[model samples]
Target chain A: MSEQKVDTRLWSSKARNLSPYVPGEQPQHANLCKLNTNENPFPPSPKVGEAIANVLEQQAYDLRLYPAPESDDLRASLAELYNLDINEVFVGNGSDEVLALVFASFFLKERPVLAPDISYSFYPVYAQTFGVELVQIALEDDFSIDPDAYRQPCSGIIIANPNAPTGLLLSLADIRKLASEHSNSVIVIDEAYIDFACIDETNSSTQVSAVSLINEFDNILVTQTFSKSRSLAGLRVGMAFGNASLIEALTRMKNSFNSYPLDKLAQAGATASVLDNDYFEQTRQQVIDLRKSLTTQLTTLGYQVLPSHANFVFARPKDGNASAVAAKLREQGIIVRHFDKPRIQEYLRITVGTQAQHERLIDALTAMQTYSEDSETISNMG
Target chain B: MSEQKVDTRLWSSKARNLSPYVPGEQPQHANLCKLNTNENPFPPSPKVGEAIANVLEQQAYDLRLYPAPESDDLRASLAELYNLDINEVFVGNGSDEVLALVFASFFLKERPVLAPDISYSFYPVYAQTFGVELVQIALEDDFSIDPDAYRQPCSGIIIANPNAPTGLLLSLADIRKLASEHSNSVIVIDEAYIDFACIDETNSSTQVSAVSLINEFDNILVTQTFSKSRSLAGLRVGMAFGNASLIEALTRMKNSFNSYPLDKLAQAGATASVLDNDYFEQTRQQVIDLRKSLTTQLTTLGYQVLPSHANFVFARPKDGNASAVAAKLREQGIIVRHFDKPRIQEYLRITVGTQAQHERLIDALTAMQTYSEDSETISNMG
Candidate 1:
C-alpha cells in the first residue's frame, strides 16, 4: 500500500505512483512444503560451490578490486553455451535486472509495447517503472498465449515462455511467425522456465528455446536466468542473447547504470554452472520427471491441472475452492501460491518438488478429500 | 564511441541517444601500480571471506532458493552501526546502483536538480538514464563546491563529499546551511571516500558523515560504499542511510526494479564487514596513513597536490603534461588516472597504495623530471 499511496512532500512523482512488483514470499521458516516461489527443490551443483570457494581462496585479496566491468568471463561462458558471439551476450544481477535494462534499452519508443495480460506480473511493474506504455492482450480460455493475439503495430512485444502461473508453452514456429511479422520491433522471449519445458508427448525432453531463431530475426532477444534451471537463485546472475547491435545497446545502458552488476563470485559460479553439462542435464531431467509425476498425481486427485510445461503447475480443485485447499495444505505445513488476481483466482500454482515432497502433498490432499466427504454425509444426515 | 553512436533501427529512442558513462579502467595487466579506479590496495576484512565461506558451506543447497529480497541482514547491520532504525537503511548491488535508484526515486520531477559540475561523472549519466533534468553548477575556481552556489529552485541536489577527482571536503557547517536552505529538496551526500577522510589536522578522521544529519534533516540522504572503504568492491555492496520516509521511497523504487539486487554472499559479507570494527578501522587507518605519506612525497617531488581527504590525491605535475607523465609511468608498469576534461586537464588522480607502491610512483615521477630536463638540454644544445 505504501508503494501505491501518494506522498507529495518528499517522494518523486515516479516513486509515489509506482506499483512495485511483489515477488513470491521467500519465507525464512522451515517445516513447510515451501512450493510458493518456483525455486528448484534440489541444491545447486557441487561445482558451483567449488567455483565460488575457489574465488574466495584465490581472490579474497583481489576482492578489494572491482569486478571486470563487462563481466567477460560469465558472458563468454554464456556465449559458448548458447552458441552466440561474445558481443551478443549481456549479463546482469538477475533476470529481473536484465529485463529492466531491456525495457530501458528497447521499449521506450513512441509506440506501446505488447504483452500477454496473464503473464509474468513484473511486466506491468516494469512498464510503470520505465514509463513505457504497455498493451496487454488477453490469453485464450485455456490460458495459452495466442500468437495471433498480438496483432498491432507496437514498439516491442514481451511474452514469457511456458508463461508463469499457467505453465503452457508457445511453439517455436509461432514465435518465428511472430518475430517475422514484427520484424521492425524487438520481441523479448522470457525463458525463465524454458528449461522445465522439456516435457514433450514422446516421453522425452524437447528443446523449446527460441535462441535458434535469433540469427534469422535480429529483432528477437532472448532472456534467461540461473534461478530456476541452474539453481543459483542466491547467486543473482541473468543473461540476454541477441544480435550484436541490440546487445550493444544493452551494454551501453548497463554501463551507464552499473558497470559491474555481476560480482566476481557470481561470474565464477555461473560460468561453472554453464560449463558443467552433466550436472545440468541430470538435474533438469529430474525436474522434468518430477513434473510429469506431479501432474499425473494432481489429475488423479480430481484437480483440473493445466498441461504444464514448466517447473510449476496451475490447478483448479474439484470443488473449485482453490484458496481453501491451499489454506488447508498450509495448515498441514504445505504452502502453495494462490493469486488474488482476476480470472485465475480459482487456480493455485504449485512448484514441482522432489518425489517425496510430492507424496507429502498428495497425502494431505487425500486426507482433505476424505474429511470433506465425511462432513458432507453428516450434513445430509442432519 | 559505440555508446554515443546512434542507431535508430530496433533500438529505443532512449538507447539511440544515450551517451553512457565510461568508468575508470580495471586493467587486466600484472605488475602495475594500478591506481586508476580508486580501489583500496589492501584486502577486505578477513571476516568478509569467512562470512562468505560460511554461506557457501551452510547454504550451498539453499543457493537454489532466492536470497532475501530486502537484504535484511546487511541493512540491520548497517542500521546498528549507524545508530539508526532498521528501516532507515537500504542496500544495493553497489553504490552506483544505489545512486541510480536514488535518481529515479527522488529526482524525476518537473523541477530540475542541481549538482556540482566537478562531482562524480556518473551523476549526469544517471540523470540521462532516468530522463531527469540536471543543472550543473560550476565548482569554485579552486575546484571546490560552493554550497551557496545551489541557487535555483530544484527537485534535488547531489554532491560527492571529499569530491571525486579533486578530493575536496565541504565543512559540516556548509552542509547544514545547504540542507536548511533546501529543506523541501532532497540533498544527496555520496560518501564513497569518506572513510579515508579520517586524517584531521589533529591526525584523526573527524566524523564527516552526513549520516549525522539524517535524523535532523529528513531530506538529507547519505550513500556510502564497501567498494572504497571496506575494500569489498568485488562484493558489490553499497548502502544508503536516511530517514524512514526517504529510505521507504528508495525501497519502493528498488523493489520495483530488482528485489534481490544484493546476492546472499554480498549480504553476508557486508554484514560481517560492518560487525568487524577492528578490521575496518585498521585497514581504513592504514589507507589514511598511506595517503598522508603519498601526499608529502608528491609535494616534495614538485607536484602541486591538492589537500586530499580521500583515498586518492589530485595533483598537477611541474610541467603539467599529465598525459606525458602518465605515459612514462605506464611504460614501467605503473598506471594512474589523468582526466582530459577542461579545468582539470593538467591533473592526475592517483590512488594511495602501500608504502612501496607510493615510493615506486614517486621514484618514477622523479626519474621523469630528470629525463625531461636532460632531453630539454640536449634539444637546446643541438
Candidate 2:
C-alpha cells in the first residue's frame, strides 16, 4: 500500500487537541498486585460464570441473530433489582459509555454543563467532543463537592458520589438537594463507587453505600458499574436508573447510535451477577474492610490519609514527597496512581489490594522512609 | 422525590433537533421469519460459543479484573484476518458504533462528508449527531453509486458496499480511484455485506470488494462485521482496518471515551468466530445459493429484482405496491422491509433466509398474487 497524505482537516478541530483520559495501569506481570485501578479483589458471583457459559452453549444460531435491540430482559432484571419499572433503566457497554451517551443526548448543549474541577476526567472530554459549553466547579478545601456552588444557570449536573481520587462522598440529603435545585435539568449522580460507600448494616459499619439514595428523586439518574464491587471490570457492564421519560430518551439515542449496545455474554453475565445478591454483598464487605484497614495503616505511618468510601485510599506522606514514594513503590513492582496535577500532586491514590499486598506496601513505605531520613541527614551535614 | 424540570438547553443543539434513526422491526414473536432487519437466519459458529464458554469457565478472578484497556488479543486476530499489522486494527461494539466514532472523530469537520443519498439511512443521522456537514450525492437512475459524483472536494467518503436496502456493491477499482483522487481524505467502505457479495462470482462478475482495495491505499478504512456471515449479530462485534496512523487516531479517541470497548465474552467469541473459516464460508455460500434461487423465483413472478450481491435482494413487485406486498406477507408471518422514502419507495428488501424460509416466502408471494389479481379484477369491473 502506498502511503498517502493525511487530511488533518477532516478530523474535528478538537480531535487533534484532545488529551485523552488515561486509565489506571493494566500491568502484564501475573504476580503484580493490581492496585493501580480500584478493582475488587474478589471474584464475581459464581452464577455469573454459569449463566455466561449457559448462554454460550446455546445454539450458535442465536448469536447469528441480533440481540434484543433494547436489551429488554436485562433491563427488566435491572428494574427488578432497583425496585423500578423497566422504563427506569438504561444499560450500556459500561458506565463510561452510558455517561458518554447521557452527555451526548442530554448533558451537552445550551448552557455549560457543571462538574467538579477535580472529577472523572472523561466528563470534560465528553463536553469537548459534543461541543458543549463547560463549567467546572472547584471542590471544597476538603476535596468535597459544595452542592450550593452548583446553583448556577447551568444546563445539567454530574457529581461522582464518593468521587474518584479523593474517595469522598456526598450525603443522600446533599444529593437530593442538588437534584431539587436543578429541577429543570438532569442531575446525574455517578455512583460508580456507591457499592463500597453504602454499607450493609448487618455486616459492617464500613458498608455504607449511596445506592439506597436512588429512591430520593426522579431527575436523578443513578449510575452504577459492576467494575469495582462486583469484580466484573473486564466484563464491561454498567447501568443507569432514572425516570421513565429520561430512560426513554437515552434508549432512543442508543438505538440511533447502535441498536445492540450490550452483547449476549454481557447481558447474561451481568444479569446473573446482579441476581446473586449474596456474592455482591460479600465482595463489597471485603472491599470495605480492606479500605478501612488501609486508611488506618496509612495514618499510623504518618501519612495524611483521606477518609475514603471507595476501595482505594489517597494519602500524602508526612516527611517525604508523595510522588517520590509512589515512584519507589513502582520500582519494586507496586503500581499506584500518581497524578501530576496541582491539587492532588502531593497525594498518592493506591488501590486496596488483598491483605498480603497491603502489608508489602506498608513494608515498602517503611523502608523508603528510613532511606529518605538518612539521605536527608547526610545532605544537611555536608 | 421531587420532579425536576428538564433543562432542554443542556443537550447539544444538534442532538436536540436530531431525528434519531429508527431501526426496522425486531418483532417479539420467535416464530416470525425475521427478515426485516437483515439478521442472518443462521447461528454463529460453534467455536465462537466454545470460546465464550471458555472465558466464562476461567477462574472467576479474570472477570473480576479489568480487561486489557485495549482488546489487544482480539485486535491481533482481526489484524491477521485482514492481512494487516496489529496497529492497523480498531475494534468496537459493532460497526455502527465504530462508524459513529469515525464520523465524530474524523469525518465531522471536514468539508461535508459524502455518501449516496439513498444509501444506508444511518449515514445522515450520524452526520447530524456529530455536527458534521453532509453533502448527499444522488444515486444514478439504476440506484448505484457513481464514483464521478464524489469528484468534488470532500472531507471524507462513506459507502456501504452491497449497500443496505439495495445490496448493490461498488467495484474495487472504483473504490481505489476514489481513494487515489481524494488522497488527502479518508475513504470508508463499510463492507457489512462483503462476505455475501464475494460468495457469488457470477452475479457480481464485475464487482470487487473494497476490502481488496485497502491493499492499494493508506487513507482507505474497510469495516467488516461478524454480524452477517459469521452469524454473531447478537454478539455486537465489528472491526475497522486501515493505515497504522489512522487506526492510532481512532485508538486515541476510544481511550478518551471508553478504554474497554469490547467485553470479555465478545472478545473471545468474536475472535473464535472470525477464525472459524469453514463456518464463515459455508454460511456465506448458503446465503448466496438462497439469494440466487430467490432472485430467479422473484424474476419469474415478474418482480423487478436488483442485481444484489449482498445476502438480501431488493425487489419491487410487478403489479403490486411494495408496502402492500410487505403487509400482505406479514399477515402470513413473514416480514420484509419496505421503505417509504423517495428513490427507493417502490422497493422491498428481503433477507436471504434458509432454503425453507425462502420457499415459504415464494409460496406466500404466489398466494398473494392470486389475492391481488382477484381484487384487481373487481376494481377493473368497477
Candidate 3:
C-alpha cells in the first residue's frame, strides 16, 4: 500500500477499522469478454422498456414526484408471482441493499449470525458494517453447506443458494431441516440464482425456491434479485419474500433508512419483467443450457468442476493454479473471476457466457494443454 | 395497532424498538394540489429523457450489466460542476440514503451527533437505525439555529441548509464558524434546498452553500440531491462533496453496505440534469417567485409566515389550527404538510406550486376569513 495522508481521526471507529467488499472490476474494454460478474447473458424482457417509457410518457416525465414509498405496484406483482400477499413482499434498490437491511433488521443480537465461510463475501462485510458478530461455518468437503452445523443458538443464518465461489447447492430437504431446527432466528435463503436452479426442465411443475416455505416457516426470509434471473442488473431492483411480520421488520428498517430506495423507473421496469414469464423462462433456460455446456468443456479439460445449479461454474484447473489460469485468460481478452481466499484460491468461478464466448475460452485452454503435451513429447525425443 | 399473530422472536432488538420514518402521503386524487412533499412542480429537463433513452438505444437496453459500482460518470459530472476532485464526490440512491451512510460512517462515536431540534426528522431515525446517540439542540425563539449552542464535544453535526419545515437558512459565515469550531468532528451541511436559497435573483453569484467550506475544513461535508432543485425526485439520485479523505470513509461504508446503490437510469438522468443548467435555473426561479406570492397572500390573511429561502414557506394559520386547516384543504383536493410534533404543531409547510395553485389557496383562505368576519358582525348586532 502507498503511504497515505488520510487522517484516521476524522472517521468513526467503525469506518476506520472496517474492510470494505470490492465488487468485480467492470473493465470498459471494447469487445472485452466480461464474465467476472454473474450477470445474465440475456437482456431484460421487452416489456421492461415499454413499461419504463410508459412511466415517462403517461406521467409526462413525472420524475418530479417521489415513487411510492411502499413500492406498491412492484410488490403486488411479486406477491402475485410468488403466490403470497402483497405485504409479504419487500423491495429494495438491489438484493445487496435488501440483505444489508436484513443484517441490520434481524441479525443484531447478543448471539452471532451463522454463514458458510465460502459463501457470499458480502455477508461478512455486512456483519462488520452493522456491528453483528458473524460465525462462519466451514462447508463440508464437497463445498455443500452442512445443515447440522447450524444447529445452535444464533441470531440468524444466511446461506446463498448454489453458494458463490463453489456453486454447490444444498437440497431443499436440508434447508427445511435448518429452518425447523432454528425456528426462532432468521434463516435467510438468498436465492439470487434460483431461476437457473430449476428442478425440472419444464420449469413449470417445480422451482427450487425457499419461497415455498415462507408461510410454513415464519423465520425463513428469501432474498432474490432482478440482477441474475430477470437480467435487470443495471436497474437496481431486488426483493424479499417472507411472513408479513418479517417483511414488516425489513420495511420498517427501510423506511427509517431511505424511504424510496427503489426508483420510479426501477419499480415500473421490474413489474413488467415479473409479469413477462415467457421471456424470463426462455432466458433462464438459456443460461442453464450454457452452464451445462461450459461445465462439460471444463471437465474435458481435466478440471474438477463443481456440480453447479447456477449461471456460473466453480472449477479447479488441471494444474491447480487458478490465479495463473485466470491471468492467462485475461491476456486472451477473457475475464473470469478468481478469488485469492483460502480453500478457494485454486478455483475459478467462471460465468456461463454465450456459446461463442465460452468457445473462445475453451479453445485457449485446449491450446495450452496441447502445448504442454507437445513440450513433453519433444523432451522425450531429446 | 391490531391483534396480530406475528412471531416477535424472529426480529432483533433494533427492529422491535426503532421507530421508522413516515414520509408525506402521495394522494392519488385526480384534482389534487400536492404541495405536501416539497417536490418540484416542474418536470426535469428534456435532456434527461433524451439521455435516458440514449442508454437504452445506444447500449441496446443493456440493463443486463451492473451499474458502475464507483458511480463513475455521475460523480465525475458532479466533481466538474462543483470544482472538486472526483474522489471528493460520493453518490447514493438518494440524499436520504447518503445521509444514512453518513450517519453509519461518521457518527458512531461516544459523543452524540448534534442537530437543531425541529430540523429534518430523518436525522433521528438514522441515528436510531445506526445506534448513534443524537443530541438535538433546540432552535431559538425566532426558529433559527444558534451556532454558539453547538460549540461542544460531539462526534458529528448535520444541519439542513434552509432547514425543513421552517424554511429558514443560515449564513455561510455561520456554517464556516461551526466547521472551524468542530474541526475534530464531521460537520455535515445537507444542501437539499440550497438552489432555492439563492443569494441573488441571477443565481450566478454568491450562492448560499456550505460547499465553499469543503476545501477549507476537512470536516465539512456537503450533501445535495437532484430530487429538490433538479426535478428528479422519482429518479433517486443524490451526492455528497467533501475532502477526499472524508469522502473515502463514506465510500468505504457504502462499499460495505451496497456497492451499486444508484441505478443506471438515475446516473444518466442526473448527469443530464446537471449539464442542463438553464432549465434548472428557470424552474427554481419560478418556485422562488411562487413562494413570494404565496407568502404575501398568507400574510394578508393574518397568518404568520416565516421568511422562506426554500421552495416552501412555513406558516401558522390565523386560526392556529394546522390540522383543521389541512383537513379543510384536503376536502378541496389540496394537500399541505402539517407536523403534529412539539413546538411546530401549529405551522403548515406548504410547497410552492404553479401561480394558479397559490391563487386557489389564497381564494380558499379568503373565503374562510370572510365567513369569520360575518359571524363576528352578526353576533355583535344580536
Candidate 4:
C-alpha cells in the first residue's frame, strides 16, 4: 500500500505523465531464435577483448582516476575510421544519447524541427522530452522520405539513414541536396545501420552512403553507433561526426552535464574495434550476404520485401496476417518484431541472423502457411 | 573562417543561451600533483579488474546484444551493499547522470527547487538545463547548510551531504528530520563522499545506511557513486536508492533515453567493487588518516582548516589569499581546488592524496608561506 502511494509532486510533469517506449522482446528462453531486436549475430573483434585485457594489465588503478572526460582516444580513432578530424567528433553513451544531445543542442525553440512522420520511434520522444516544436513530414507512399518536404523554414531537420522498420535508405546525393538546400538549418543523419548500408558487393545500387554527404556541408551532423556492426550493442558507445563548430556546441553541453560519459573499458574496447578493419569487413560482408539470401527466400514465398540497406529486412506476409504469423513463429521457439502502429502495423521487421537462424525463421513461416491452408479447408468442409 | 561560425539557432535557449558549469581544471601538463579533481590516487580493488577480464573473455561476443536496459546484477549487488531490495535502486552513468535524472524526473515544473547557494555547482546548471525554476538558499557564515531554510514550499530539496568544496557534514538526525518534515517533497541526499565523511573510527556512518530511512518515507532518494569511494570514476557508474515508484520513474526515463547506459565491462567491474568490502575499507581508512595529517600540517602552517569529514579538506590560508596560495602551489607541481565565488572565495578545497603526496602538498604550502611572510616584511620596510 505504501508502494502504491507515490507523491505526484516528486516527479517531473513528463516523468509523471510519460508513455515509455517498449523495446522488442529479449526473452530469457534458451532455445528461442530472437529476430525481434535488430542485433548482429556475430561477436565483436577478438582485438576488442585483447585491448580490454591490455588496459587491465597495465594499471588497473588508472580506472580509479577519471577517464578522459571527452573520450579523446576513442574520438581520435573514430575520426580515422570515418576520415574525419578529431575536431569533428562528438561521442556519447550511445547513438540514442548522441541523438538526444542533438535535439537538446541544436534542434529546439526558434522554429519547429522537421523529421519523418514514420522514422526512428525515438525522434518524437526526444522532441517531447526537450519540449521542442515538431513538424512531421510524411514518407512517400513506398515508405521513403521526400527531401523537398524539409525545404520549409524550420529550426533543424533529422533523418535516420536506412531508417528503422522500413530499412530504406536516403542516398548521399539526396542527403547532400537536403543539406545544401537547408544550409542555415542543422541536419542530423542517424546512421545507426550505415555499416549494413555500405555492404553491397559488385558496386550494387543498394549502397547509399550518407556519411559522404558530410564532406560537402557545414550544417550536417552524422551519428553512428558500434551496436550493430561492431556487435557491441551492450557497450553503449556512439559518436557524432560534424563540423568543428557543431561538435564544440555538443562538447560544451556534454561537459556541463556529464564529463566522464565514456567509461575506461569502453574507450579501450571501442578504440580496438575501430582498429580491427578485418573484423569490420568480415562481419559486414556476412550480414550483407545473409540479407541477400533472406530477401530471395521471402520473394519466393510471394512476400513483398522492402529494399533494405540496414541490418534487418521489413516485409509483410503474403498469405496470412502478419501478427498472427509472428505469434505462430514464437510458438515454435522463434521471435520476430511486429509494430502495431499506423502503416507499419501490417509489416514485421526481422533482424537477419546466422544461416541456421534464418532457416528456422523460414521453416516457421512455411509451417504457419501450411496450417492456415489446412484450417481454411477444414472450415469450408464443416 | 567557417569553423569559427557557431550555430546560434540549433542549441536550446538554455544551452547556447546560458553559461555552463566549469569543472575543475585538468591541465595537460605532466608531473603536476593533479589534485584539483577529487579522484582517488589508489587503484580500485584487484577483484574488479579480474571481473572485467572475465567478462571480456566470456561475454565480449554478447556485446551485440543490448545490455539489460537496467543493469540488474549491479543493482542487486548495490542493494545488498545498502541492505535494500532490488526495486529500491536506480543506476546511471555517474552521480552526475543520476542527479541530472533527478532534475528531469523529480524536480521539473514544480514549485522552484531549493538548495544551498554554495552547494554542488552543478545544481543550478541542471535546473536551467531542465527549464525548472530555482530558489537558492545561501549557506551559513561558516559555509554549511542550515536545513531549516529548506522548509519553504518547494518541489524538492537536493544537498550534497558532507557537502562538497567545504567538506562539512549535516548529521543524519538533521537529514532524517528534514525528510520527515518534507515528506511530500522529493529529498535527494547526494552522498558522493560519505565514505570519507565517516573517517573517524568512532564515526562509522555510511551513505548506504541512509537507505533504511526509505522504509518510513517514499520521497527520499539517496544517490551514491562508484567514482569517489569505489575508486571507479573512469567507469561512469552510480546508483540511486529510493521508494520503488521513484526508482521506476528514473528507469522509465533512462529506458526512453539510453537503454544500455552501463556497458559490459562496467557492470562486471562495478559489481566486483561493490562485493569487495576489504579493499574499500582499507583505502577509506587511508584517506581518513591522510586528511587528519593534512589538517594538522595546514593548521600548523597558519591556515584555518575546517574539521573535514570527507576525503578533502577545506582550508583558508591565514595570510588571506587562497587563490594566490593555490596558484603558487601549482607552480611547484601541486594542484588544489580554489573556488573564486562569493562565499568560498578565500577557501581551498584540496583532495587528500597518498601520504607522500600530502607531504609534497605540505612542503609546497610551507615554502609559499615563507615566501609570503618575507614579502610582507619587505613591504613593511618599504
| Stretches of candidate 3 exceeding 4 Å from the true structure | A1-3, A200-205, A375-382, B1-6, B200-204, B375-382
lDDT for B212 in candidate 4 is: 69
DockQ of 1: 0.74
Query: Candidate 2 at residue B353, lDDT?
Result: 89
**Candidate 3 accuracy as TM-score:** 0.97
Task: Please provide, for model 3 over A1-382, each residue's C-alpha lDDT reduced to its tens digit, 9 standing for 90 to 100.
Answer: 1228666778889998788998998888888888899988888899998888777678745799999888899999999998899989999989999999999889999999999999898999999998999999999887888799888899989999978877777788999999889888899999988888855644533757899988898889999999998999999998999998889889888989999998888899999999999999888888888898899899999999988888999999878989998998899899999999988899999998989999899998887777768886676678
Runs of candidate 1 with Cα error greater than 4 angstroms are A1-8, A199-205, A375-382, B1-7, B199-205, B375-382
Candidates sorted on lDDT, descending:
1, 3, 4, 2
lDDT to native, each model:
0.89, 0.80, 0.88, 0.83
Residue A246 error, candidate 2, Å: 2.2
Per-residue alpha-carbon lDDT of candidate 4 for residues B148-197, written as tens digits (9 for 90 to 100): 88888888888888788888888877788889888778989888988887
Q: Score the docking of each candidate (DockQ).
A: 0.74, 0.51, 0.74, 0.60
On residues A245-356, what C-alpha lDDT tens digit does candidate 4 reach at each position? 7888888777666777888888888999999998798888899889989998988876799989888999988853788878888888888888888888888899999999
- RMSD after CA superposition, every candidate: 2.6, 4.2, 2.3, 3.5
Better of 1 and 3 by lDDT: 1
Q: What 10-residue stretch in candidate 3 chain B is worst by lDDT? A: B1-10
lDDT of 2 by residue, A129-222 (tens): 6666779999999998888999898778988888988998788778778878887778888989877875343455452334455566657777
CA shift of A289, model 1, Å = 0.6
The collision pairs in model 1 are B198-B205
